[model samples]
Target chain A: MTGVEGYMYPNEIRLYWSVLIVLYPYITGLVAGAFILASLERIFRVEAVKPTYRLALLTAMAFLLDAPLPLLFHLGHPERAWEMYFTPHKTSAMAMFGYVYLWYLMAVLTFEIWLDYRRDIVLRSQQTKGILRVIYKIMTLGSSNISERALNIDERVGWLVTLIGIPSAFLLHGYVGFIFGSLKSNPWWDSPLMPVVFIFSAMVSGIAAVMLFYMLLTKMRHKTIDMRCVDAIAMYMFYIFIIDFSLEMLDLVHRIYEANESFRSLNFLVHTKLYFSQIILQILIGTITPLVLLFITQVVKLPEIARKRMYTVSGILALIGIFAMRWNVVIGGQLFSKSFLGYTSYKIHLVTREGLLVALGLTMLPLIFLWILLKLLPPWEDEGAHAPAAGD
Target chain B: MNGFKDIEHLFRFAGLFVIAILVFLVVRGFIVPKSFGEYGHYRAAAIPQIAALPLHYAGHQACISCHSDIQAVKSKGMHAGVNCEACHGALEKHVLDPINVVPVKLNTAVLCVRCHAASAAKPKSFPQVNAAEHANGIACETCHNPHSPAIDAGGTK
Candidate 1:
């Protein structure tokens, strides 16, 4: 009752979905967007974007590995999750997640990464000695053939997989959007534009993440950052960000214009309860600031250092904006009751199963996975010949 | 011919992937409940499994077995349709083993006022009261029997 401002349905007092649900879509969007960026190089033949190609794939893989974790942690019975796969209900949107996840994990991301790195994996296995050597050998799956013809086939198949992967990535994130959008009971979430906005925003966030990682890793390696690659990535991020912003605004404007019975309640919620997260953090600071920074780089010919700094700032802001967007969608949608007459506040716990601590750990877990993945399969093409020693 | 030999391992790996998926699907088929997908998308067996759970609210029959006097008074009152558990909390344990489990003694003002609280949203026909104005520091049970809220009485039946 302390958080409750008005009369709420007895059952609507507690929010069923937590911050972890927000993270689920946020993390999956990054995976989808990163994969799509990677495919731009492989399928679209965007050679200028080739430097971040492998980095994008590995980034996607790392985040994809972390994506299901939030859902698992959020479940009342984590052990019963496999039941979604074992006894999937045909009608439920959530029931299809298990299969879609498996397909993207195995048939798309993992297979593509393996095929692209088959030659390098075999080479690394033979070159290294000790536990890592055994690990790489196992990863190779007994195929040591890296001849010209073998490499040719790997490239061909990898291309086909990337072509398939582009759509799969769309399905992966679009389906997540549909889950929230299709719920007609919540006017805040119900929108036909939700999936399209989700897909574009995902691209924006994923590209931003990879760009930041590319710059950070290159600096750590003491190598020159690929200007062309970052430039192209920024260009794509800029265009996609515009589309994402437009779609979101369109949804907002439509909601305002329609002004249905639920409008007054939802509008009051946005202005009052969600004012900071939605208006301040998401729109002004997170979205417009990053868009302006990226747009500046597009028009002005700045020094390399200046451009890098701008891109870095923009990328970080974009990531924050997209995350805020997800938070607004997930948490804001539940702030008001379905009765459209009351409101409640979300108090995040510190040590509970789906607490802030767990959310932080789950968020950081992807970077840890990415670090290991980078070590396992160095995305740097130049290092292919003198591959870093395993576990190095 | 030479190229085919070089990529033969890739084919084998693909074959293994397919076989692994098939095996998983087969196992899933066996594990799924037989009655699933009967009435709807969910497992029909879950209906019985859920219904068979220990009745925590102690249906009216269970409450009347011991408190028959209260039931007679409640049957003729406006609160007849409302179950005892609606206010008193679940009493399955108290009903089965009264020596160990006890039915909670609720605060009458807090318990009764929840439904009868003055709210514009509440229907006009239903009895409504402002606890602050109607009883001010007095308990609801001081004036009305909880089992028969419509009858203003000083004590329980």
Candidate 2:
């Protein structure tokens, strides 16, 4: 009664999808994005991006591990989620998510990362002592042969896995888009281009995140930053970001042009309820500003330090923008009622299961995963067994 | 298979994946609902299980059987079509033990506002009101009889 305006169905007064659902897409997008970046070196032969290959893989793996957590937290009967995998409804898009997530996590990402790191794992299995040695030995899965020929097979399989990973990464995030876009029930989410937009934005966000990580990690290690690698990453990020922005604009323009029945309500939502997240955080600060920063570094011959600064700022903004885009989609979509005559609000609780604290904890959980992953199977050449270079 | 000497690890991985898939399928066969996919993707028994749930709201016939006077009053007015349980909620317990299971007093101010509140989406023919402006949170029963809401009970309207 307090927040309700105009008219709303009794059920429409409370929004089911909260910030936890917001974190769902953001995490999946990061995982998809990171895997795509790793694939650039492995599949596309983008040698300049080689320095970040293993790091990207680890980042993807870490985030992928945490991706389903939000959904688990959001469910009323969290335990019954297994029922989805057990009795997957054929007609449901969300039902397919479990299979897709597992396939990507197991069949694609873990397989590729393991193959790439297998030689190292085998080496460490022999070189390390005690408990650590046992862990590495188990990780080897009883294939301890690090012979030159065995390593050759690992490389070949890893490359093939990378080849599969590119499309798997697309499906991973594109499906997240379809979850929304397929909802003809909500005009805000209904769009044919949603998946494509999600994929490109995934690429953009993933590339930028890895770039930031690569630079920061290198600095933390007191090592020289890979200018060429970051440069190539920035260039690709800029191009993909342009495409992502164009598609989003196309969606917006189409909505405005069609001016469909739900248009006025949605338009009002974007202007009023969604002004900060959509207009300020997503478009102006997140997208355009970073695009400008990247474009500047592209045309001008700035010093490495200046270039790094620009790249850093752009990466932070890109992540924020993509997150805002997700916020606008999940939260903003629910602000207006289906009756088309009223609006409601979402207030994220503090101490509840699907609360702000859990959301924050989930966001940070990947970084902790990355830390553990790094410590266990170090991605750095000096720290871990570096997989063989591109060709034999 | 003859010259696969150095690639034993590849064979091991392939074997491992095959075993995992088999294990998953075998386990799924046992855990998944037996009647699942009989008529559709979900368990066919779900329909009957849901149908078997105990009825909470006794039909109006059961209520009017005992209290025909109230039904006569309700039937004579615009509230004739509205069911007793619509306002009284589930009455199966009340029907069984009417004396001990008396329904609690409802806040008519709140209850009446649920349907009568001004909403643009409501059909124009419905006698909706801006309840806040109309009575300033006063109980609907203060001025109007709920059974025949069109008539003012207290002669205050």
Candidate 3:
């Protein structure tokens, strides 16, 4: 009663999609975008970004693993989710997600990672002892021969997978965009540009995330930061962020110029309820600030320390902006009634299954997984020197 | 020949992945309902399962059977076509087990105003009244019999 203003339909008072739905696309976009960054090194042969290649793949896998947990937790009957795979509705775009996810996970990310790491895994298996040795051995899947010819084949096959993975990554996140964009009744979400915007923003966020991880991890390991890699990544993030901003603005301008029946309600909702999230957080702080920071780094010659600081700040801002973009798209779309005559509010619970606490835990779960993944398979080249000999 | 031996394990791993997927598909084939894809995408059995649900609404016939007096008046009114359950809520329990279940008494003004409240969106021909101006805190049943709203106390009927 308090949040309700004017006349919402009896059913419209409660929003069906919650914050978990916002996390779903945001998480998937990271997976897609990170995979694309990894591919830039493997497929595009961008030598400068080679430092973050393994890190990017591992990051993508970490987030990819966490992507479905939100959707599963949100379902009233989570156990019945296998129905999407068992008896999929041919017409439903959502039903196709299971297959798409499987293809990306098994055929693209997992396969590509396995091929890339096959030689390292094999070498580690022979060069370790006790539980770690057995773990690496099992990971090798009984493949211990890391001959030059074998490694060559691995590189070739991995390259081919990365080539396939770029488009698969696009399909993965573009499909997420289509899910919201296809909803004709919601004028706020229904736009042909949604998938393209989602793809470009995903690239921005993914590149930013990998860049930050590369800088932070290098500093943590007492190694010098890879300035060339960060510079290249920051450049990509900047250009993609510009495109993403342009597309969103194009959508906004078109809506205002058209001034359709739903425009007044949408405009009012933006000015009032969405002012902080959309305008302040997403547009100004998250997007413009980060874009300007990255632009300054590109145009002006700065000290290495200054550039590192700039990239770090810009990367964090890019991530926040992309996340805010997802939040606005998912939450803002539901804040107003389909009738365009009323508005309702979202109240995020703390302890419930689909609550703020659960979302925070889910968000942190990926970083934890990434930490474990890094420990198990050290992506650094120097890891082999510290490993025990096969004879020992 | 030595180079090919190093790559042999890769083939085995690929085969295992393929076989695992095949096994899942085979299991899925068995678990999925037989009539699932017969009509469209949904399970066809769901149609009959839903149709077999217990009726919650007592049809007009059931209401008229017990309250013929009200039915006679309602038959002559503008609301004759509208089902009694639409305004009164489902009365199947009250009709079937009168001792335990009692029909809910609705607030008459609120019930009438739900449909008749003045709104620019409503069709111009449809009867619309500003409930606040018309009722002025008085119940609708004070002036009009809900069964025959047009017939007044002035002996016009």
Candidate 4:
């Protein structure tokens, strides 16, 4: 009531979905986008993008493993979540998440990562000695066949899995979009374009994440940054970013031009409550700045160092913008009352269950997972036992 | 059998997947409610489970059945439509064991104005009053008979 401006429904005072829900789609976007970037090399025969294939896969794997944490933390009884799988209501969009997540994680992602790494796992199981050897052996699933014919089968199957993975990645994030889009009760989330926008935005975030990680990790290792690889990646990232921006603008313009009954409430929310996150962080700094910077690298002939610096800054900006976009969608949707008369406020607690601390921890947890993953299964071609095959 | 050795591990992988699915199927059979998908999408037993809950507030009919004297005065007053539990709170336990479970005496001073507190949102026809100007720090029941709000108890108004 203190935050309320006009007549508000009593139940509208406290926002239900916290910043944790915001992190859910954001993490899932990174997962989807990274997987799609991996696919660009695997399926499209984009040789210049080949340097990032394994890194993208590992990045996707790391994030994919931790994607459900926010939801798990947010649920009242986190233990009862298996019921989403055990007794699913087929009609509920949210219910299908368990299966979609499992399909992507287990069926698509794990299987693909395993297939690609099986040759290494089998070799390491025999080559290594000690605890890590056990991990490799168990990972090999009792397979010692890393022969030419055996690896050929693995490659062939891995290609097929990558083929399936492209759509599964789309389904993985597009479904996240559909969850919000299908919520007809809320005006902010209800959009036919939500899934497509989510997929493309996911692509932008995923590619940018891999790019940044690639640059950072390379710098740390004192390895030369592969200009050809990053250039191709930047080109794709730029084009996809354009599409993502256009769709978002289309949604914004459509809402502004139509100026429906809910527009006044949403407009007020954008100008007031969501002024910084939506307008400043998401649109101006997050989106436009990066797009302009990336555009410069595309047209203008700049030094490699200058281009690299721009790309790094742009990647960081794009990620921040996408995160702000998710925050605006999740938090902003709940800020305004459904009555279209009043507004509410959301202040995320620092130490509570669904607080900023937990959200920040969850965001960082994947990078730790990636670190462990990179150590266990080094995505670098030079480090890996198996070379990137000339996929037939 | 001879060539199976070349792809023995792949077969083992598929076998493991099959076993996992079987395990899930077995577990699903144990946990999933039998009544689920019986009546549309929800568990049908939920209705019965909910119906079996202990009642907290006895219906107004139960109150009037015994306390007909108060009901007689209340029926003719401005508060006729208001139920006893609306002001007094839930009394199912009191109704069941009236001797041991005595209902707490409500402070009518604060309780009365919950609905009567003047707000622009309330319907114009409904009775409302500004607490400061109307009472000047006095209890509402001291001036007005709560059972019959129009009848002044103290003749102060």
Candidate 3 segments whose C-alpha is farther than 4 A from its true place: A384-392, B1-6, B46-53, B61-76, B93-107, B117-133, B151-157
Clashing pairs in 4: none
**Cα displacement (Å) at residue A260, model 4:** 1.5
What's the lDDT for candidate 4? 0.90
On a 0 to 100 scale, what is the lDDT of residue B113 in model 3?
A: 92
Give TM per candidate.
Answer: 0.88, 0.90, 0.91, 0.91
Q: Tell me the tens digit of each residue's lDDT in model 2 across B50-130.
A: 999998999899999998988877887788899988987889999999999998988889988888877777789999998
Model 3's alpha-carbon lDDT is 0.87
Model 1, B1-157: lDDT tens digits are 8858878867877887989889998987788878978998778889988998877778888989988998988888888899988888888889889888977689997888788988766789989988899999688888788887765432452
Cα lDDT, model 2, residue A107: 89
Model 1: docking quality category: acceptable
Query: Which runs in model 1 stand beyond 4 Å of their true positions?
Result: A386-392, B1-3, B22-77, B83-111, B119-121, B137-157
Runs of candidate 2 with Cα error greater than 4 angstroms are: A386-392, B33-54, B64-77, B93-113, B131-157
Task: Go through the candidates in order and give each one's DockQ.
Answer: 0.44, 0.56, 0.51, 0.50
Tens-digit per-residue lDDT, A1-392, candidate 4: 57778767778889999999999999999999999999998999999989899999999999998899999999999999998888888787888877888889887888889889888887777778999999998999977877787778888888999999999999999999998988999999999999999999999999999999999998998999999999999999999999999999999999999898899989999999999999999999999999999999999999999999999999999999999999999999999888888888998899999998999999999999999999989888778764445782
TM-score of 2: 0.90
CAPRI class of candidate 2 = medium
> How would the docking of model 3 be graded?
medium
Candidate 1 residue-wise lDDT, A257-332, digit = tens? 9998899999999999999999998999889999999899999999999999999999999999899999999999
DockQ leader: 2
Best by TM-score: 3
- Record all residue pairs in model 3 with backbone atoms less than 3 Å apart, i.e. clashing: none
